[model samples]
Target: MVSSTISLAPFFSLSPSASQSQPPSPFAFRRGLFLVCHAFSQSESQADKPNSWRQLHWKEKRPRRKANAISDQEVVHQFDQLLAAKNLYQINQYLKDHAKTSNNSYPTVFSLFTRLTQAEGIGPDEYTYAILMDCCARMNQVNLMFGFLGRFLKEGHSANNAMIFSPILKGLCWEKRTGEAATIVLYKMAKLGCIPGIVSYNIIINGLCKNDEIDKAMDFVDVMMSKGHEPNVVTYNTLIDGLCKKGEIDKALDFVDVMISKGHGPNVVTYSTLIDGLCKEGEIDKAMDIVDVMISKGYDPDVITYSILINGLCKEGEIDKAMDIVDVMISRGHDPDVVTYSTLIDGLCKEGEIDKARNFVDVMISKGLEPDVVTYSTLIDGLCKKGEIDKAMDIVDVMISRGHDPDVVTYNTLIDGLCKKGETDKARDFVDVMISKGLEPNVVTYSTLIDGLCKKGETDNARDFVDVMISKGLEPNVVTYNILIDGLCKKGEIQKAIDIVDVMITKGHEPDVVTYSTLIDGLCKKGEIEKAMDFLDVMISKGLEPDVVTYNTLIDGLCKKGETDKARDFVDVMISKGLEPDVVTHNTLIDGLCKKGQTEQAFNFLDVMISKGCDPDVITYNTLITGLCKNGEIDKALDFVDVMISKGHEPNVVTYSTLIDGLCKKGEIKRALNFLDVMISKGHEPDVVTYGTLIDGLCEKGEITKAKELFYEMISKGVDPDAVI
Candidate 1:
């Protein structure tokens, strides 16, 4: 016997010369040669003797042969006849097959099923309703699925089939109605004597994890175990991923141990998830250790694993280390994909290495990897940070030319750049462009604009943006509220700042540390130290720890009011809170003490500052010198200038002006004249103050000729003498 073969060319690909739109019809051969061959193949398999080529050719040539002759309409007519005879088993079987084989044409299958049930003398059985329910589930009409379930129960069908309830559980879980899914799995399924299998439980667990209901997901795992359904690797991975995402890496690691003990070893996905969590938590070293453990277990890290590690390194500002990993990835035959390159670009941009970041974009393009929206956004962010807004705009143009529409993040980056450069108008225009492009400005976009306006002292304009943002249904977050309060404070509108804080709380935006810090600083600047202190107590009561900026603000406020002792007491309080005083704190204190004629006390604090390893900056030394000169200690002030220079601090115009006035006030006329020559020789031009002090000294000495000559010299130097002269 010879086996006949059918050529698939005519049934599949079209000829090169065939009209592209006029290909062979699928139904043309589907109802003809395809069915004839199918019937012949079945008969040949069951035959006692193989059929000859002549017999096979006869079947192929006469595709309308009896067994394969029925048209689709005739088949439907026969199905209606079966339904009329109440042969429900056959009707249900046909419907079940149709539902399963419908692919995505679920609505059509459902319509056919509905018409069959509505036929005269036709009633759908339990299996028919189950098929209908499955159809509803597939169509995302899960609400209509319940109607089919009702029909199944009304027909007195057994509810013991777990498969029948699986679709319902899946639909509910997919809709994030995990509470209902759980109720069905725990109570309704039991009521129907249908115990859910692992697949059904896994679906609910996965959904719960995705919705950030990790605790509830874990409780279901316990229930699943109690019900004798052992959790699989997928079950454990879902829980681990949920825990990791919630920043519960320790708990996620514990789950990994539990998973291994239960004989389900962690796979690449499990390790990658763990590494990603650790990286996000800034535990890059620990993440690397996990990767090593993964490799020791014979599971080589894939591209995703490498990308996660690179991202972690980039986030930690270890850009060079991240690049080393990229090289290792390529050497190991895994290419650095767009995500890996984008992560590196973001890192470089953050480090202010904009040129290097652009070079990376070139490298990525050279490797035939198209820069994604994230990659382009990162480059734009880098340029914006470097104050190259025009170049950033050029990158946007290039991004558009490459068919990549700028996403919300891309627009937000551009807005942030423009606003920081004091181009608030341009930023606002971009907002319109974003809306025109069908992307609504998100919270970050509005927040950036609000912050820019506030920084430019346009508090009124900033307030308008806040109102617009709310009208757009985007509520002001804590950062937004903090920006508004800080702006109001700088404008001396403490009452308005407080009102904004009140509105923030009313809107359920609890004041974080930044909010309280900004308020404290504002109140301090307004000289309402007592109220600022009261806010401190409120902040502490609310469990928000005041940071260094808050304490520095309070200390500066007290020192300014000649309350140096109280400022000292606040320092002790700040230290007690475990926040060591920074340079700003010490400078504020020194400036306060010097202003109060407590030179010895100021010098004592200076020693303490040094002992605490807080090096004095130029302001620190200048404040001390100003105090000495005010106390008529000319020699001491002069000596301190030498010490300042010895400490590598270059005295600016203030330093020279202060010393010149000190010498002239002491009537050291020759010394004052010599210091002026030294000031000029040191490239410090004499300002009106410097010359006025010298000219006044000459007049007091009754040297009218020298005073006139000095005044003439001041005029020649173009130093505009003020009324004090």
Candidate 2:
């Protein structure tokens, strides 16, 4: 608080006028002795008693000065050097001690440096401020950093003082306190009369980009240019990288043009940033173009460049191309590292080439690249997805033996796999093992377990587990709510599902598309179509668009009610909204039409379907045939069956059995018997349904002898007839 000066004389018993004051306080004496021993130990040699502090006045002249003394230059020169050196040393030790332990000493030692230097008429140099600013930044003490900045500015420093701002900027930016960094440079530094130079601006720009403030970062680029600070490649790269990550890759590439026009041509990092952004957008070909451009610019694509392409390719399900790039990467003398191998492993696993992925892991090990936690995690996740959970656990054991600590992601994958395989009890045991290994269960971990428990028909246990998660301070996320909602729906507890949805909203959670879709589907399945419609309206009102699943569920409900026309009308609405109906939607409508005896209308729907890019599969044809048989349009159905075969669509047993049943129902018992022989010639053996359908049709026609013959033949084929037969 005493900014005027720290009178070192109060700490020492250095009083020539002894009668003027009381004895120095014990606290003052101890502090003075500590300062003398710590700072002025070298000056003690000239003391009369070599311990008596009467001659010392910190930077005071040897004896008390009245008329004249050593010149100010002589006194200041010696005192400044001594003060700066001692203060710098003390400030460094404080920083070192604080860096290792608690940094509570920041204020204590920073005050000592500034005050002692000021009292000695010596300005604290860059080294003094550098250490202090870094200490403040590391401690996240912004106020202390600004205090040092104010002092530095007061010393008439200018834009060239990067040394002052650089460390502070790095510290703030490193901690992602970029907005504060920009505040200091954009407003504070200028207010203090030190217009920020390019380095300070660059740091702030990178921070802004890092904080996802791409527009703000771009606007600052203008400020940098207006202030006559030419934006360097780093500034452009930072802005471009941010823009790309935000899915503004085109805007990023525009900056690439701007950068080159300004003569700060993009470097490896700039090109790599663009490549990564393009690849993330699934523009792998565009990324390759960028790579080619980099080579044309005499900058060879580095490992990161190729890895970005590989990652992008793999994501697009282009694993073959990703592997080709791996070969290309090796030929370029840039060996694929663990990251490269891990990405390939992940890609291969996703492509269901799990065995190939396993072999690649061994190849990585052979190449002397010890798989890190990520590599092991990728492999474990792959094995888990393939339902080789025991293999995943074995990998985990091997990973542990090799000193690779399986991260939470690894265990979560395993737990999820077990849960999906209906091993909820095993999953619970894994959760305990995870805790024993000092791995805390995160939201995903707990959520997966809750889902597993709910799936195993343990709804009460899942509800209790939610409380346990809350007790542990892990809030249930939207996925967790959706999983529980699904479980409640499956149990026919519609009210509970609605109540949970309400709770989700009350808890400040926005029910996303999945949440609404699950509720709608559940209601549809339970034949609560009107309630499902109500949910649909609420979902739209909440500004959430009804996705394909939402629309499909409602269509399915209408179709199941034999309201094919209503379902057909809903499909038009979906298309009007630019939501293309998937194959499931078309098939649902087809089946509905068939059930309502509109077999011909179902054929018309199929024609309209192919034109709209929704292909009718085997299920669609089977539904139409059943409708025809029920309508006594047996011969026309036979011609359609020939059309199906000519179109390379094989009619399975459903088609054959439907035709034979139609014939027998029409009292063409002999023709139906011959059709059965045709079915056998096509390598299609009569199963229980096929035999039952024929037997029922024959009995209804009063052809007991033919029915008995078919019954004996069915028994010879080992086809057990149902009670209906």
**lDDT for each residue of candidate 1 in 223-322, tens digit (9 for 90 to 100):** 9999999999999999999999899999999999999999999999999999999998999999999999998999999999998899889889999999
What's the distance in Å from true for residue 377, model 1? 1.5
1-725 per-residue lDDT for model 2 (tens digits): 11112234321111233322334544554454344333322322222211111112112223222333344345336544556576555544544444333333344444455455556444556666777777656544444455555455455555346667776787678678776667667765664456788888998888888788888888888888888998998888888999998999889888889888989988999999999899889899998999898999899888978888898899999999999999998998899987788888888888888889889989988999887666777778788888999899899988999887765667788999999999988998988988888777778888899999889878889998899999987778898899899899888888898999999999889999999898888898888889999999999999999988889999999999887788888899999999998888888888888888888788888888889987677777777777888889997888888777787789888888888888878978778878888989989997888788777878887888878998999889888877877
Evaluated with TM-score, which candidate comes out highest? 2
Model 2: lowest-lDDT 10 consecutive positions: 49-58
TM-score of each: 0.68, 0.76
Cα TM-score of candidate 2: 0.76
| Candidate topping lDDT | 1
Candidate 1 deviant stretches above 4 angstroms: 1-181, 199-220, 246-255, 502-512, 537-545, 575-583, 599-725
lDDT, candidate 2, at 682 = 88
Off by over 4 Å in 2: 1-160, 163-180, 642-725
> Which residue pairs in candidate 2 have backbone atoms (N, alpha carbon, C) closer than 3 angstroms, thus clashing?
none
